[model samples]
Target chain A: MSTDPTANFSGDIAGDILTTALDWKNAGKGVALATVVTTWGSAPRPVGSQLAVDDEGKFIGSVSGGCIEGAVVTEALDAIADGKPRLLDFGVSDAQAWEVGLACGGKIQVYVERLDS
Target chain B: MKREILEQLQADRADKRPVVLATFLKTGEQRLLYLVGKKGLKDLDPRIGEAARAALIEDKPRTLDTEQGPLFLNVFNPPLRLILVGAVHIAQALVPMAQLAGYEVIVIDPRSAFGSVERFPGITLSNDWPDEAMAQLRPDLRTALVTLTHDPKIDDPALIAGLKSDVFYIGALGSKKTHASRLERLTAEGFGPDDFARIHGPVGLSIGAKSPAEISISILAQMTAALRQPAATPASSSAAA
Candidate 1:
């Protein structure tokens, strides 16, 4: 357990993840945030996970799905369309990723977009 | 929705409201440590001293390697979340598990018989279709969604809608055979076969789970794994495309 004094994990990641995003959003900068909302069988994660990305192909945070991130990054690019927030998803509600990633363990969905100022 | 809460946390940070973010990282021993703060970010950790300050107090994202393994520094300015799509018997099991995992869970279901405050006590309850009720709840990168409804009428449309949005983990309950049938139907409705393959059919791993409640445990366990680690393997869709 990292009980480091003066270290705040809550504010840093949350801040680092959103600070630039919100700044870009406020400055009318193009930014996208993709998050994991659900999962299915054999997945390595739970729901309520996230991954943040930008139009330039820069990224922070994890859509958290291991290898499928490349695909999710593609979705983040789509979110940059017209600079509006949009949703993106990968995997099935109950099916598994056989060839692409892992099988019966993915089924992840994400929301992407240029942060609303 | 998990995003709403995360948004609130963001607002709290912008306003410098009191908040804390805790993540269970797999470190040298996979220890459970919470990063607590609301701007001051000091005096939060009891182990704080002048020597270990550099490791703990740094003005950047961190990755700490402990005796167990690598400790992933997950930020949570406003705490954690819990987004539930169904209010069923299995949910009864998941809600507690989520809360135990340090999440604030909110459940949604349209059926009154299934979604009742009486049944799900001490948790946020919303009686609405999973798809329609999404707007009411907000989910973010830090948020996760767990759909336990086995009924396609409730699960499918909601899932399709979720598929198009930014919510993590769209889990549904069904067997491999049931999933195959569902996949055929989805393909008939224009969903690509590759797309259909994303679903975690049978809902949970083949841990030999039988009942709904037991399935819920298996499913939640899987969800926890998804959160704790990176997606197991990378997909090769480009090869197919």
Candidate 2:
């Protein structure tokens, strides 16, 4: 918790993520944004969390606490290339969850969609 | 998909309208619903629009499993607002404090000198009369109304307007005797005790605050408590001198 009154964290990142996706698309770089649409149990992030990824694998924001960001980024890359959306689900059942120490446990569904200007 | 919706969403957000952008998971089709007021950009399925409106009212963002398929209803709310009915010394201290607490502060005072920018740097100033300005602002559930002038003419009308609205918090600054007299005047105008009870007279918590800045802190603390803990009982009023 920052004591600086000027430090504001109440802002939601959806608008910023969307604006970045649009700008990337307009700049001739394919872009896709992954949004956490659903969460069950102790999900690290809430629903509506977003991560924007360009064709070059550049990304901003996060849908999870590094537990599933890698997979989301890969899916976002595929979404940008195919111009189709992918709903990717990650949870404790997967071996990767244990590898990332996310077994504290929860399920998160990220909807990765391409952004075309 | 047209980028026009993105532009419109930006515009709606800039306008501080409560809006929800619902997107179909399968097709990536999106619809913008202005859920705060009845007005909308497009006429959507009544079920979805109503659900979106309910979500906006609850201030929640969620993915709803609808008959049309899974749709993510992303809720966007305007910044919380604090409308100060009087640009008194306390308001000068309160404005920046409220702004720091993530509230978009608006100060309303008919007296130009009192409401001048020099006294209240970087805050929205409304010089209109309290009743007129309150009507125009139309404080919603996300807004907090506070009157610090201690003048019945200025503070009473503003309190009436606030009482009529759905603003989550209402506080009036005055002494205990002044509050009783003020209550009498409002009662003479047909307002009952129940209506007056909604007000936190001798405004702010019973924190034994003396300085203007200290009082502002107490008021902001009370406002935050009212907003975050709606179920909690109101704090007891301290004797005002």
Candidate 3:
């Protein structure tokens, strides 16, 4: 099928995430959406950044550039399984940043919730 | 009732309606408000509703920190569209450049030969009269209309449509003298000086462009400036610089 330019959400991360979540839900795959709700000081991604995860751990988009996606993904997977929501706080401290392999200190609050219906 | 929001949001997205999806950070409560369509709820908190309206107007997604909590006002604006009234050499370059710069371009020319797919491969071509084409295209605030044709028959109708609508930027390709005459003609046709204020005559930023490609670059640059800075006026043909 020829791709319609109007239907393509390639570059828009927010639209892509929403589209992916809906597609996964329609495909019988449990899906969860993680969004960056708040950020503090040098957060890689600004607020409203999103990462959508499928039950199989397949994912697209990002809540952070790279710093906390892994953690968010893990939380997202759990959210999909439990059908529960999680608000994750990452890199609030220098020690936390070091643990997450972030050289600098910043904070990001990500809300992960399963996509229902 | 809740699934309705996502469904409506997707519907609005499909229809190219500008919307703001406001999600309360603390509660995950979501509300979708169309920027210019049927107002969803009259009872919505005035402050938050105003914030959503402001976000839609600004065409920027932002998280507003209110006394209750942080609300992520995600502005999903319809893609910016560029309506080129002439399928000339400048459009040959401008079409791709505008597409690259994230605009959906529509090339309008009543001349079937000039607007052929062979000339504008993979581009949206409208072979209708400029007024009819522009009426169908319905240039909104997110759209920029450029008339590269020096012909008044083509460009004047497009300019009239642009002036009547809220199209953010309207530029016409011409020399300073040509633009002065064009303005006079438009004024004679009932358009006032205030209506012509937004028209960027000579149609480009003055970087001493000499080629069609360079001229296209300047036009795109001016369009970008107009979209991003609606209040600031760029140097136009009438300006001394």
Q: Pick the candidate with the highest lDDT.
A: 2
The CA lDDT of each predicted structure is 0.54, 0.78, 0.77
Clash counts per candidate, in order, are 61, 0, 0
Q: What is the DockQ of candidate 2?
A: 0.34
Question: Which model is ahead, 1 or 3, in terms of DockQ?
Answer: 3
lDDT of 3 by residue, B1-241 (tens): 1446766776776666678887776677777876555486475667777788777666656777877677777766678899999999899999999999889899999999888999999878999999999889878878899999899999999999999998888998998888889999999999987887889988888888778898888889888788777667554532222
DockQ of each model against the real complex? Answer: 0.07, 0.34, 0.27
| Decoy 3 TM-score against native | 0.85
lDDT for B122 (candidate 3): 88
Every candidate's fraction of true contacts kept comes to 0.15, 0.42, 0.17
Q: Of the candidates shown, which would achieve the greatest TM-score relative to the real structure?
A: 3
Q: Could you give the DockQ of candidate 1?
A: 0.07
Q: Rank the candidates by DockQ, best first.
A: 2, 3, 1
Question: Higher lDDT: candidate 1 or 3?
Answer: 3
Off by over 4 Å in 1: A2-117, B1-60, B63-79, B188-190, B193-197, B211-213, B233-241
For model 2 the TM-score comes to 0.76
Say which candidate scores most in DockQ. 2
**Ten contiguous residues minimizing lDDT sum, candidate 1 chain B:** B232-241
